[model samples]
Target: MKLITKFVLLYLVVTIIVLGIGGFVSYHIIKGELDNELKWRFLDRVERVTYLLEQGKNFESPVQDNDDTNLKIVALPNRVEPNVEIRDTLVWHDRLQQMEHNLKLVAHRNVDGTSYRITTYGALVESDDITEAVIQILLWILGLQVIGAVGVGFIVSNRLFKPFRKTLERIKNFRLQDKNPITAEETSVAEFDDLNKFVEQMTSKAITDYKNLKEFAENASHELQTPLSIIKGKLELLTETDLSPEQYQLVEDSQRSVKKLSRLSESLALLTKIENHEFTGTEEVNLSELIKDSIQSFDEFITLNGLTVEADVEDDVFVHMHPVLADILWTNLFQNAIKHNVEEGNIDISLNSQRLRISNTGNPLSSTPEELFRRFKKDNVNSKSIGLGLAIIKRIADQYHYTISYTCEDGWHTVTINLQN
Candidate 1:
């Protein structure tokens, strides 16, 4: 749930409990006060009736009394104890022809040697009636509170969360390589302000780190190229010097090692560039055409390896990729296939709208299928292979969010590439 929603619900729950308790207390308080009021009204009526009796107004006859409309006063010619009594009782209403609850008050008085008893009755509010009344009042109050709470939540929640929503948008669109990257937006709320401040610090640090890393990669590649080129030149000159057969063999081995080192450096630099997103230019590449061209280019190598080819490339199979990266991806794929293929074995290539699969007849791999995509991982550790070809292919595929899988069965190594988004 949203924070605003949770908070508002909690507040409403508390309000309901408070109102419920208040209603309960209010019912009892009001009922008590009303009972007292009824008693006082009954007592006042009794006093009026006593005064009329002293003035010789006969209360026995309704016409002669001229008072005590809701009272029954009677006298006995004997001395009796004087006291007052009040209670609730049920009485029959002659006109309404029904029984009704009432507050009945009785007074026994010894006035002028006569035991005078005066009774007064008042309409009583039943428990159910009083409860209903309190509930109505509480309902009205609760309804108003609910409406007000919802209104305030709607009004305040949007305003309060506006900065938070904008912060989310900023984070969503943030790009480390963008010239103008996202920075934290200023907010009035302390929590949101702190969040924005932290975001600003982290983004600033990330941009600084990215710049340093990218600069280091470029500088390192350039610096290494110059020294490697000079060393290669010196080795070529050293090869020209007349030397023993053993010395010449050593020179040849050193030259091969230097070339391998040069290639390794280039492959590593390419991997770094791909990771850094330097291949930003992208276009729809015709995979079918590219693979056909690649196969033609490596035809001599395939012939030298004594391998047979079977290509079922679908026409105009397109993928969104950088032209250079596309070429590198296919080149690495074809190279891996040919370099690992057995003599007089078959190479089967399939391409369609969904995926591309290349299966080459080769010896069973010594490493796991997953290890084929890891850098510096190879089937034969002693081979001249730099162990970066499949790694580079996997990295390029990953950069474009493509799925690449490897499988080996029956002396056939298969690599599948799915480029669909």
Candidate 2:
């Protein structure tokens, strides 16, 4: 979840819990106060009736001030001890034809040895009034909370987090080779300022380290090429001199080894250059034309190996890319399929607007296809492959944000490259 969303949700939850507790407690407190007030009113009415009776007033149907309050006098069956009792009771209402809830206060006393029951009642109206008032109050509180929480949570938080968001965007756009430093708008928030500073420092250090590594790789590769060439030349000269059969075989093997080493060094240098994004310039190139040309160039090799080549290419599958890299990518893919196939194997090439697929009849891969994309990983260990072809292909695909995958089924190995728009 986003920071603003989480903060608002948490605030709302806490506010609800607090309001629920406060409302519950307030409800009970108001109810208690109303109960006490009702009881005292009933008690006072009972005292007035007692006083009237002691004054020798004749017993009659006593007057009721309101339907909610009543006074009644009843004769006891026998002389009872003097006492007072108060409780809640339900009285039937003649007019309403329903039970009316009331608080009944009764006083039992003897006057001249005559038993009399004097009772007073009061309706429980305070509870209903208090409840209605409390509900209205809670509604107001809830409305205010909704407004305050949403408005303050969204508006204030968005303003407060703006600096952090900008800082994060700058950090995400930071590139190791780019010389620009990460920056954001100045803010009063100290933490965001500190974060931007840290990000700038870190990116600067990363760019410096990357430059050092790239320069070293380029210099080392350039420096090794001259010595390798000199060694090959010397070996070629040595081969021409008079020598025994065994020595000649040895020299040939040495020459072959030197050639392999030279290829490996060149591949490594090319891989380094690809990673450093040295091939930044791009042009419109027709991939279909390139594939046909590559096929024609490899005709001799294919014929000598007794391999059959098939091409099902669409017309004018154009792409914008570095011309050299595109050539390398297609060459490596074609060579990979050819070099790994069996004798008299069939190579099928299919190309359309969206994808290019190359399938070759070959021995079942000893290693998984996923591992073949790692540097120096090969399916056929007995083959004379330096094992960097698929690795180079994968790096180029990644550079263009394209997808490449391999699959093997029924002695057929397929390499698919998905060209994205």
Candidate 3:
């Protein structure tokens, strides 16, 4: 729940509890006060009746005054009644034809050596009347309080949280590639200000770190290329000299080592560039055309390895990606297949809008398919792989936000890539 909503609800609960208690107490208090006032009036009637009897007035069936005070007086010939008695009882109303619950007050007095009993009745304050009135008033107050609290809480809280909402929007759009820090609007709230400062610091540091890493990627490839090329040239010249067969073999092995080292450096540099998001300009590239071209280029290698490739490529299926990365993606897939297949094994390639699946007949995996995506992980460590092909492909897929999975079952290795964005 929202903070404002919780606050409003809690306030309403407390207010209702307090109002209920106040109403309960007030209901009884008003009822008791009305009863007391009625009793006082009844006593006044007894006094008046006693005085009239002393003045030699004769007894009658009943007597009533202008205030509707019902009174009855009886002569107690040679006997005295109780000093005073009061109770609540039901009396019949002749005009309304209903039983009316009322207060009856009786008093005994002696006048001129004669005793008489005096009784009076007064209407009581009905508890139900008081209860209904109190409830109505409490409900009105509760309704007003609830309406006011919800309306004001939402309006005020919207303005108060505007800064937080803006900060979140800016953070979502922030990227290290932009090289710009997120600057939030100034606010009086301390917590929001703290958040703005922290995000700015974090993005600023990330951009600077990406820049340093990018510079290293460029330097690592260029600086190492010069020495490697010179050494390769020297080895090529040494091959022309009159060396023994064993010595020639040694030189050939050294040349191959140098070439492998060069390829490894280039592969690592490419991986770093992809990680840094260097290839970013994306266009609709026909992946179908790229796949067909890759298969044709590796025709010789496929034939030499005694492998058969089946291509079921659809025409003009486009993927949004950098053209250079597109080429690298399919090339790596074809290379991985040819490098790991058994003799006279079959390679199956399928492509359409929704997916691209490549299944090849190969040996079982040494590690789980997931572990193969990690850098420097390989099935055959000494198999001239350099152990970076699948890792590089995984990075390129991640760069384009593609889903790629590897699985091996019954001597068939499959790599399924979901082409949807």
Candidate 4:
């Protein structure tokens, strides 16, 4: 439901509960007051009737009298001779019939010769009418209050949510490539104002970091490219000059260094692109086929190094990932295994639903496990290694939400990639 509707409904429910309780309380209070007033008016009428009988002012039968304003009256004859008992008996019977209103009648006999009973009948008071009128007015007031409460709730809730709505609009229009940050100046609440400020800071920081990283990558690539090109050009020119065996060996080493530098630059560019989420569409790829292709490409290296290769991967264990990234990960891993293995060493490759484990007999890394995955971090023993192979694998694993771990035990270096399901 919309926020405003929810707020209005909540307000209505609370208001109704409060008004119902108030109405019940008012009704009971009015009823008690009306009953008390009737009791008092009845007592007053009884006093007046008893006073009239004591004065002996009645000239007609009390039952048939119409001059009494208190209540109806009925008279009966005495059962015995002239005595207080007989007079009390006549007054009791007369008062019983004279109780015309909704009230009870009782008799009291004094020791004197004069005796009388009083009629107790309720009276109709104006307060009862006023109480009914007030109840009706309260009902009308409650209805007006409910309407007012709903109106106010709608206005307040809408105002409170307005900033969030604008923030959503701004987010929808935001683009990562846009250098300028998206900010909101309109806010209806303090919490939203703070949120807007936080979002602006985060977006601005992201833009600044992206620009700096891109510039650094470009500048570093250009700086490295200049020397590599000069070395290649000089090597081509040295081909025409007569040189000793040692000079020829030096030229070959320079060419190899230039080639390695070119490859390193390409790898760095690929890592940057992957970090930027450049790969978009994805498809299911069979791991067994990918490993087979990688093995075929490195078959010559495996044979020349006299390495034993073992594969135990399933045929249908597939993953939904970017094909190019998957190829790069496996290629780097297989190449690293071949490059770091001992002569005639055994390389074991295994895959299952849980993970892919590659183990090879090679020189174990002396650094800690945490530092092994860091870019450009290699053991000082192997200066020829570029140190970016495992780092690229780490980047790919992160993109696919996978886990990569390295272990060295008993002269065997192992790399495990745990696939996320």
Q: Name the weakest run of 10 consecutive residues (lDDT summed) in model 4.
A: 83-92
How do the residues 353-388 of candidate 3 rate in per-residue lDDT, one tens digit apiece?
Answer: 998999999988888999989988988787777878
Q: List the residue pairs that clash in candidate 4.
A: 63-73, 63-74
Task: Indicate the residue-level lDDT of 170 in model 3.
Answer: 89
lDDT of 2 by residue, 7-119 (tens): 87898788888888888899988766776887888777767767877898776766565544777888788999988898878878776687766677888878767888888
lDDT of 1 by residue, 108-211 (tens): 97666788878777565765679899999999998998888888888777898889888988888887777455567778899999999898888888888889
Measured against the true structure, the TM-scores of the candidates, in listed sequence, are 0.69, 0.85, 0.71, 0.57
How are the candidates ranked when ordered by TM-score, highest leading? 2, 3, 1, 4
Q: Candidate 4 residues 193-241, lDDT tens each?
A: 8888888888888889988887798789878888889889989799669
Q: In candidate 2, where is summed lDDT lowest over 10 consecutive residues?
A: 59-68
For model 1, where is the 10-residue window of minimal lDDT? 61-70
Q: How close is candidate 2 to the true structure, as a TM-score?
A: 0.85
The C-alpha RMSD of each candidate to the native structure, in angstroms, is 6.5, 3.5, 6.0, 11.3
For residue 86, give model 1's deviation from the true position in Å: 18
CA deviation > 4 Å runs, candidate 4: 1-185, 190-194, 201-205, 219-227
| C-alpha-based local distance difference test score of model 3 | 0.87
For TM-score, candidate 1 versus 3, the one ahead is: 3
